[model samples]
Target: MLQLPHQSLQVAAVPAQRTAAREDQDGPWHTEAVCRRDEAGLFFAPSKEPTAARLSREDAAKRVCARCPVMVECREHALLQPEPYGVWGGLTAAERRVVLARRRRREMELKKSASAA
Candidate 1:
């Protein structure tokens, strides 16, 4: 996996606080799936929200993802499966939907162009 120079620097300079947040296990919901595996299997599950927060603790997740060496792998995984919950690979569910939609549209356009040719 070739990382861009900026990406290497980003990983190297990640804040310690962000790294520790990924290890926190006492959140109302278990977001461990966001980082534990290469696949986005458990990320789509519904879980209890923390009493004090309206949004899930996905901001911390985005931070951890920023430093992930396998961010491309994780994005590809989310794209393949279309995980419907939580943030992954620097994208929220809504963002991933847009990405997948664009990808499909591009593929369709390519196929149409090929057929016309």
Candidate 2:
């Protein structure tokens, strides 16, 4: 079985202390993540994983994300970090890429409109 770091595993178990620390370091939103209660393997793929298995695992992780209260924050973090692996905020790596592309395009369009005006 894959084991997460001790700190990651303890997030939900020690909410008050962890939330305060995480808020100081990363942000308060992470303290409310539902994924903290699940196994890390559910969100990240194992090395050399098969496509079907990876899809199934990602789907399961997304289901957990779907109900999360901090999903938007998590997704924004992933997009800003351009997270290269795993499923974050109900989206796989490929999905994040598409979103980034769209964001870039929109920004470019906005810039063009501003310059034209």
Candidate 3:
């Protein structure tokens, strides 16, 4: 019997904070996130969070994101997944919602204009 060379399929450990797939290039980027090494709680809002506190926490999270090498990638991933909570890629959940809403409105306007033309 001869053993041929083969690639081993090893599963990477998933962190508790991970809420998205990590199979893509985004995985490495996410691993480099400053949030990963810092207090995870800071990236997420507490229950019954006040608007002011949410804003302040989000600002602090964004500051960390500012120095992250993969900030853009992380942000794009968050926007695409439309992550429901936490400060991801420097954006709060509310901000991602706003962006989604704007994109939807833009698409509708474009469709309406195209149909009218």
Candidate 4:
């Protein structure tokens, strides 16, 4: 895991689209901040494939998420956008579904409590 510098929590502002000089896909902003990488024999490299499958990619993401600083924000974005592909917020699609279910459950519980009170 990369030890981020000690600075205030600043949300990374990813441009909706990349600049002409730098294509959206060919920049640190796309991969470094948004994707997980694995530490190989002696180097850290991004995952070869961006798509997620059953276990391999999930395992890789779990390791990267163990140290990601903006995991919360990432997950929130993924949930809100209903991203159909790739790993986001350190969670796979199925995991995000579980999270959404839990969140909805909690919201219902809160509403019930408020009504009873």
Clashing pairs in 2: none
Q: What is the lDDT of residue 104 in candidate 4?
A: 92
Query: Alpha carbon lDDT of residue 69, candidate 1?
Result: 65
TM-score of each: 0.53, 0.77, 0.68, 0.53
In candidate 1, stretches whose alpha carbon ends up further than 4 angstroms from where it belongs are: 1-34, 37-56
Clashing pairs in 1: none
Which 10-residue window in model 1 sums to the lowest lDDT? 8-17
Q: Estimate the Cα RMSD of every predicted model relative to the unseen true structure.
A: 14.3, 7.8, 14.0, 12.3
* Span of 10 residues, lowest total lDDT, candidate 2: 8-17
**TM-score for predicted model 2 compared with the true structure:** 0.77
Please report, in order, the local distance difference test score of every candidate based on alpha carbons. 0.52, 0.71, 0.68, 0.51
Root mean square deviation (Cα) for candidate 3: 14.0
**Clash pairs, model 3 backbone:** none
1-117 in candidate 4: lDDT tens per residue?
Answer: 332234112122322422123223444333544343433211122344333322553565566665666556566667876664445667767778888889999999999999999
lDDT of model number 3:
0.68
Choose the strongest candidate by TM-score: 2
lDDT of 4 at 12: 27
Taking the tens digit of each residue's C-alpha lDDT, what string does model 2 give over 6-32?
312111121221222234345588877
Query: How would you order the candidates by TM-score, starting with the best?
Result: 2, 3, 1, 4
